[model samples]
Target chain A: MALRREEILESARVLFNRWGTAHVSANRIASDAGVSPGNLYYWFPNKAAIIRALFAEWSAASTGVALAGLADSGDPGDALREFVHAAERQPAATARYAFFPRELFALLHADPELAAAYRRNFEAGVDAITTIAQAGIDAGLLIDPAPRANLRDVVVTAWIASECAPAFLEVIAEEPASGRGSGLAGAILRSLLTDEGAKALDERKGARGHEHRGIRAG
Target chain B: MALRREEILESARVLFNRWGTAHVSANRIASDAGVSPGNLYYWFPNKAAIIRALFAEWSAASTGVALAGLADSGDPGDALREFVHAAERQPAATARYAFFPRELFALLHADPELAAAYRRNFEAGVDAITTIAQAGIDAGLLIDPAPRANLRDVVVTAWIASECAPAFLEVIAEEPASGRGSGLAGAILRSLLTDEGAKALDERKGARGHEHRGIRAG
Candidate 1:
């Protein structure tokens, strides 16, 4: 039963990615999953239910894993980069979930329950980034631009900007594929850093470069 | 006839703002407008047409005026601030159009013509900002961060971030009203400015302060 449900979700994700959530139907999802309509119904009551399941799995995989890595990382700057890199690599993992971010507001407005769940996940992600910022401050690697902005707000704003800028620009600007914005997250992060924070980030990048070379040499 | 059309549009905007585009029916909109359904049909054949009209009006009010101002402004820094300030003030002018930014992707996917029109307006807006950036460079008030980052990309990214960040964060984070991120657009713009650009901005801010004081004293 679990295997069958996963199969249905996989099929829905593919279709939803290609045609978007509005155009795809339950029947199409069922057929694509190679399951009888009855069997599909047994696992999922409707198309919305399938979408909810997909979101649940995606939220867990994306935010959940990033939070865990953030908690485990020793370097705050590295953790911040890893978090963004994880989100950046998500497209390769499943381009099918692109609709989630693309239609985020519509989906949330349509489903209050899903919205509530998604909100919790999003908050958790923001909180994780905030923790990293705090860690940077405590380590003397970050300076607070006090009286001007809050550390948490700066970090959250940067994360949201990085995550949404590309998608928003693509939708509104109709930018060419080659013209897609890149490294915006890193740039925003760097802009928020103090001189000390910037130095630390540079050192981390240098260390990572050396590690990459050592691996190749090995 | 024009007055009645405006009345209908006003009514539709109110209801759409309150209930979103999908839930509101033509009948409800007609009744709210105090017009018969026949009259409503005469003006707009369907709900989709009404949405398109709303978008057209919004595009004109929001982007059109800002582009004109950008063209007129002698100072690139002031022009950038004006463009952002105009967009920021729009929520007060008519929060009804919040739906346009909120459901941007979904609306675009559903209506190709609306999408095309919106794309054109968005590109024009970006181009205006790019021109301002070029002017800043020509005046030696802004330095190109070339070999590191593209000025146009940074400006566009900052603009998109500023326009979309507050709404996106509000929706996803369920952030409290008091906890809202403020001055994000200005902060981002400041971050992208060269030292010379930053100094010029500070001097302009000081001049504006004295002008306000002079007006009050008079």
Candidate 2:
């Protein structure tokens, strides 16, 4: 029964990613999972329930991945570089839930429960980002990117850019296949770093390039 | 007949902006407009048609207002300030079609025709922004914010920031009354400006402050 439930969720994710949540029906998800409609209904009372479950799963998974291994880094530039590296390493992490960002507002509007959960997660993410920026400022490795707005504003702006840039880039602008990297987000956040911090980030990038070649040769 | 058509369109805009496009039905739109169902159908064959009509109207209106009066400004700083001012001057211009950005991907996926039209308009907007940035570079008024990325990349990042920031700010982060201005977008774009350009922008801002005070005194 547990395996069947997992199958249903997996099918729903694939279908939602391909055809969007609105276009894909509950029955379609069940059939795609090769499960009977009754079985699917037994697991999830309705489509919204399935969506809520998926969001919960994604949210839980992302919280660990978003700022992993960067908390203890004393150097602001190292923290920023790892932040971008973590993002680049996990394109599939976000891409798996591609439909979410694309229809974020619509999904939130449809399910108030999901909206509440998402709001909590989003606020937490913002706070996490703000803390990182504040640390950088205290260390004098980061400067205020926007002189008028506060640090929270800069964090929110960077948060929004990182969150929405992928969808806009792939869907609207139709940029050529460089969609996997979090370069734009990195660029925005790095703008806040002072010259010394920027040098650290650039040097890290050079090291990463060498590591990639070494791996390829090995 | 024309007046009735306009009424239906206006009602759809209001309801879609409030309740979202997915929740609002054609009958509800007709009822809101005080028009018969048949009359609404006579004007728009389906909900998609109404959405398309609204999008067309918005695209036309935004094109005119987007870069208004900034094209002729010889100073890059002046152009940048005017660009932000144009955005600040017309909150309603984008807010009127608030649902469009929120549900952009869903709407596009549901209707191929609308998606094609939107893509065309979006590409045009990017091109227009790129031209402005290029001019700034030519005049040495702006430097590339992202040294690794090209000018178009910078513009695209700024465009995405401007396009998606409002929705994310209001819906996700729940910021206060400051959602009206395009400050995040202005900040991202202004990052590209050189010291000379930045000075011009700051001076203009100071001047605008004096003007606001004068107007209040009057």
Chain A TM-score across all models, in listed order: 0.79, 0.83
The residue-by-residue lDDT of candidate 2 on B1-218, one tens digit each, is: 79999999999999999988878999999999999999999999999999999999988766544465356466555555556566565446778899887887678767889988988877777676666767666767666544544555555666666667667666654762234365565666555556766666667676785644422100
* Steric clash pairs (candidate 2): none
**Under CAPRI classification, how is model 1 graded?**
acceptable
Q: List TM-scores for all candidates, in order.
A: 0.78, 0.83
Model 1 Cα lDDT, one tens digit per residue, A1-218: 79999999999998988888889989999999999999999998888899899999878765754485386477665665455446545544434477787777778777878888887876787678668767766766554433334555555556556556545655665452225334554455444556566565555455553633422100
Alpha-carbon lDDT, every model: 0.66, 0.70
- For each candidate in turn, give its C-alpha RMSD to the true structure in angstroms: 4.8, 4.8
CAPRI verdict (incorrect, acceptable, medium, high) for model 2: acceptable
lDDT of 1 by residue, B101-200 (tens): 6777777767888888887876787677667767766766554544344555555556566556645755665452235334554454444456566566
Per-residue lDDT of B128 in model 1: 78
User: What are the runs in model 1 whose C-alpha is more than 4 Å off?
Assistant: A64-72, A133-147, A162-173, A176-187, A190-218, B64-72, B80-84, B131-148, B162-170, B176-187, B190-218
The best candidate in terms of TM-score: 2
Q: What would the TM-score be for candidate 1 when compared with the true structure? A: 0.78
List-wise, what DockQ does each model earn?
Answer: 0.33, 0.37
Share of reference contacts kept by candidate 1: 0.25
